[model samples]
Target chain A: MELIIDRLTKQYKNKIAVDRISLTLNKGVYGLLGANGSGKTTLMRMLCGVLKPTSGEVKFNGIDVSQEEYRDSLGYLPQDFGYYPEFTAYEFLLYMASLKGLAKQSAKDKAKELLELVSLSDSAKKKIKTYSGGMKQRLGIAQAILNNPKILILDEPTAGLDPKERVRFRNLISQLGTDRIILLSTHIVSDIENIAGMILIMKDGQIVHKGGLDEIIKAIDGRVFECTVDAGEAGKLISMHTITNFRQENDKTFLRLICDKSPCENAISVKATLEDLYLYYFKEVNTDEKLF
Target chain B: MDNNIKRKLKSVFEAPMPAKKDDFLNQLDYPKASRLDFIKSQAGYIRKQVWVLSLLLFIGTLILMYYFEVSDSVIWILSSALPFISLVSIGEIFRSITYNMDELEMSCKHNFLEISLIRFGILGLANLAVLISLLILLAGKTDFGFFRLGLYLTTPYLLNCYGSIFAVNRLKNREIVYVCGVVTASVSILNALFTTQINDIYTDKYWSFWIISFIILAVFSYKEILKLIKKMEELKWSLSLTV
Candidate 1:
C-alpha cells in the first residue's frame, strides 16, 4: 500500500511546529532523523490523524487519515505513551487489541503471541507498573504492530532500549519493513544508519534532506575533515567550525569538524557518515549525546 | 503404551487440528469489534475499586435502614451520597486523556470518543442499577412515595453527571471534572439538607415543581450529553494541534 502526505502543515499560535511537508511512502523502512522539537512528533502525529493539519491532508491508498478505514490500516507509537499501571502486560495488549477492533479470542491469541515475541512471555501476567522502561518500550512496539497495519509510525521507539535490546528491535523492525510502510523517528543515528532504506532529515520544522542513505551522505562529501593539532589550535578550530568529535591525545588534539573548506593546516578529508551530515545541518543543536 | 494409545485415540477424536497452527495468522482480518463487544471490552478497564466502594456504600446504607426508623430525611441523605460513586467513573473517562494516551487512542480504529462514551455508558448503567435498588429498598420502608423516591435519587446523580460531562467537554484541562463534581455534589447535599421534611415533598404544590424541575434537568442533560460527544469527536483532532 502507498501513503501520501500532501503539503502537511501544523501551526501553533505564534510558531509553526511543522512546516509544509509533502512526501509519499511505500513498503519499506524510512528513518526520520531530527533533533528534539524539530517537528518529527508533529509530523508523525499528523500522519496518524492524531493532530490535524492546518492546510493539507494525509491519505493512504486514497483513504483520508481521519477516516476509520485509514486508521484500520495504520499503527502508531507516540514518543510519550501512557499505560494503565494496573493492567498486566497481557491485559494491556489485549485491551489495545480490542481498541484496534480485534475480536476477543483473536485479541487474546495475538496478545500472547506478541508477549512472546517481545520476550515478555515470562512477565505476561505481571502488572505494567512492574516493567522496566525498556520492557515498556517493547510492549509499545508490540502494540503498534498488533493490527499488522499497512502503515506503521513509531516516534522514538528505541529511546529507552539498551544496546542489545536496540539491536533486537532493529532486527524486528527490519523484518516487518519488507511488507509495510514503517516510518521511525529517532535522534539516535546508529538506530537507523544500518536499517533504513531512506532517511528524511528534519531541521527547524522542515525536511532539509530526504533520499537514500548514501545519497544524503553525499551532501556532506569533502566537507568532513579530521585533523590533529595543538590543544590551543584545536580550541580555535572548534570555535571556527562545527566540531562533531574531539579528543585529546598527549599534547595534541584530534577533531572531526564539518566545514566548507579546510579549517586548519594539515586537515585530512574523511568519509562522511550520517552523524556528520546531521551535525552539518543542525549546527547549533547538540544531537551527539543522543547517539548510541 | 496405554497412555500413548489413549493420546492417539483422543487426537483422532479431536477436530482435525483446526487446520494449520498458523491458520489464525492468515485469518487475521482487520480487527473490527461490534458496539456490544466494544462496550464489554471497555468495561474491563473500569476501576474495580469503584464497584467495591459502591457495594460497600450500598451495604452500609442497608444496615442503617434495617436498624433505624427509615424516613424521608434518611433517604434524602443517602441519595446525596450516591454521586460520589459516579465521581470515580467520571475520573476513569478522562484517565487516558489526562495521562497522555489521548493521541494514541485517537489514532486507534475505534477512536477516543467511542471508548469514552462506552465507559460513560457502563458507569451510567451501573449508577442506574444502584439507584433502582435503593429506590426499591426505601419505597416500602419509608413514608416517601414513588415520585419522591425517584426524584430524590435521580437529582444528585444527574446533576453530577451533567456537570462533569459539561466541564470535561468545555475545558482543556482534565482536572476540571473533579471541580465540577465537587460543586455538583455539594449543591446536591445542601439541597437535600434544606428539603428534609417528607410533608414538604408530599404536597401537590412542591411535587409539581419538583417534577417540572426534573424534566428540565433531564432535557438539559440529554442535550449536553450529545454536545459532549460531539465535542469529544472534534477535540480528538484539534486538541493536540493547539498550543
Candidate 2:
C-alpha cells in the first residue's frame, strides 16, 4: 500500500511549476502546506494521474500512474471541479460511480450511503444548482470517497467550508486516515495543524521542510523572542524583524517576532509555534537556517 | 420534528454507520455494468433539447412533404438540415468537457474516452433515426429513388462529421467545430445544386463517383474521430504536465 513519487517535475516552456520533488507514503494523513503558486495543486494533480510529469513518475506500489489498476485505488478532488447543474446530488454520484466501474446497484447504494455520510441526504433529490457552496464542497468530498479508494487526494477541500463545517470535515478525514493514505493540500495552516500526523511545507515550487509538527517547530525554537516596547521603540524593532504578533497594553506594546539575534535588551526567547515556524520559513526574505 | 425525522437527523451528523461501510466495500455480488448498461445510462443523459429539436424537424418535414411536390431540389433543401442535426448531436457529446467535467472524467478508472464513446454512440443513433425518417417521408414521392436519396442524405451528413472531427483536434474552442460544420453543409448544398448528379440520378454515370466519394469521406471521418480522441487525451495530459 505504499505510494511513491520519484523526482516529479513539471516544466512549461521556461517556467517550472513543480520542481523535482519526491516522497513515499503509506497509510496516514499528510498535510501539504504552501502559499499560492507554490505547486501544491500541481503535485497533487500528478499524484492523481490527472496530470503527467515531464521528467518523473508516480507509482502505486509497482504499478504506473497511467495504468487503470493504479487508478482503481485512487480518489481525487481537484481545486476546481464542475458538476452537471441539471443532475440531482444522488444522480451525480451515481454517474461518477459508473465512471469508476462500480456495479449499478452497488453504486446506487453507495451513492445513498455517501450522501448520508456527508449530511446531504435531505437534498439528494434536489438539483445541484440550488445547493450552497459548503454543501457542494461536502458533496465533492463524498464523491471522492465513493469508491472506497485506498489513496484519497483533496486540493483545498476546505475552501468554501464554514468554520464548523471545516471542523466536521477534519474529523471525517482524521478517522479515514487510519487505514488509507490521505494527502490534502491547503494554505490554511490550522486546518491541518490538529489532524495531520506529518506536514510538508512548500515554497518556490519545492518542499523546504517536511516533518512532524513538533520536529518542524523545533527548527525555530530559540529564534522566537517576546518583548514589550514603547511605540517609538516598537517602530524601530518592526523595521528590523519579522513580527508574528503585536498588541498594545498600557503605554507599551507587546510584540512577538522571529530573529537570529535578539532585537532588544529585554527581549526573552519563547518556544516556537507552527505559525511562527511557517513565518520563519516562508517570510518575504529567506532566513538563516543554522538550526535544523 | 417527528421522532423518525429526529432520528434520521441525528444519524446524519454521527459517524458513518459501520455496517453500511463494510457492505459498500465487501459486496462482491454487485455486478459491474455491462456495455449495454453504459449505453442505456448515456442515452438517459441525452439533453432534452435534442428531443425537442428532433420533433420540430419531424414536423417541418411533414409540412414540407404535404405542400410541395417532392423533387430533387425539395429533397436537397430538406436534407440540408440533417447536417445541422448531426452537428448538434456531436455537440452534445462534447458538452461534458465544455462544462469542465473532463478533469474528473479523465481521472476515473474507465477514463473519459469510454464514457464519451458511449454517449457518442447514443447520439449517433438519434442522428441516424432522424435521417432514416426523412428518407422514408421522401421515399415514394421523390423521383430521386433509394440509391440517389441515400447519396444526397449521406453526403452532407458525412461531410459534417468529417469537418467536426477534423476541427476538434486542431481547435481549442468547441464553437470553432460548429463553424467547420457550417462550411461543410454550405459547400455540400452548393455542390448538389450545380452538379448534374442530383438532377440525373437515373443515369449510372455518377453512381460510382458518389459511392466512392461517400466511402472516402466516411473513412476520413472515422480516422479523424480516432485522431480527435488521441489528440484530446494527449493535449490534456501534456497541458497538465506543463501546468
Best by lDDT: 1
The lDDT for every candidate, in the order shown, is 0.83, 0.81
Q: What's each prediction's TM-score?
A: 0.88, 0.84
Docking class of 1: medium
TM-score of 2: 0.84
Q: Can you tell me which runs of candidate 2 are displaced by over 4 Å?
A: A246-253, A285-292, B1-31, B136-140, B173-220, B235-243
Top candidate by TM-score: 1
The DockQ values of the predictions, listed in order, are 0.53, 0.45
Q: Candidate 1 chain B: worst 10 consecutive residues by lDDT?
A: B234-243
Model 1 DockQ reads 0.53
| Local error of candidate 1 at residue A90 (angstroms) | 0.9
Candidate 1 per-residue C-alpha lDDT over B1-243 given as tens digits, one digit per residue, 9 for 90 to 100: 699999998888865556654445544575567868887878878888979878987897788887888876676677678778878777787788666677789889998878888888788888778888888878888666766888977776777777776676677764565676676677677667656744566456677777777788788888898987877765543554333
- What is candidate 1's lDDT per residue for A247-283, written digit by digit as tens? 9899899999999998877999999999988888887
Clashing residue pairs, candidate 2? none
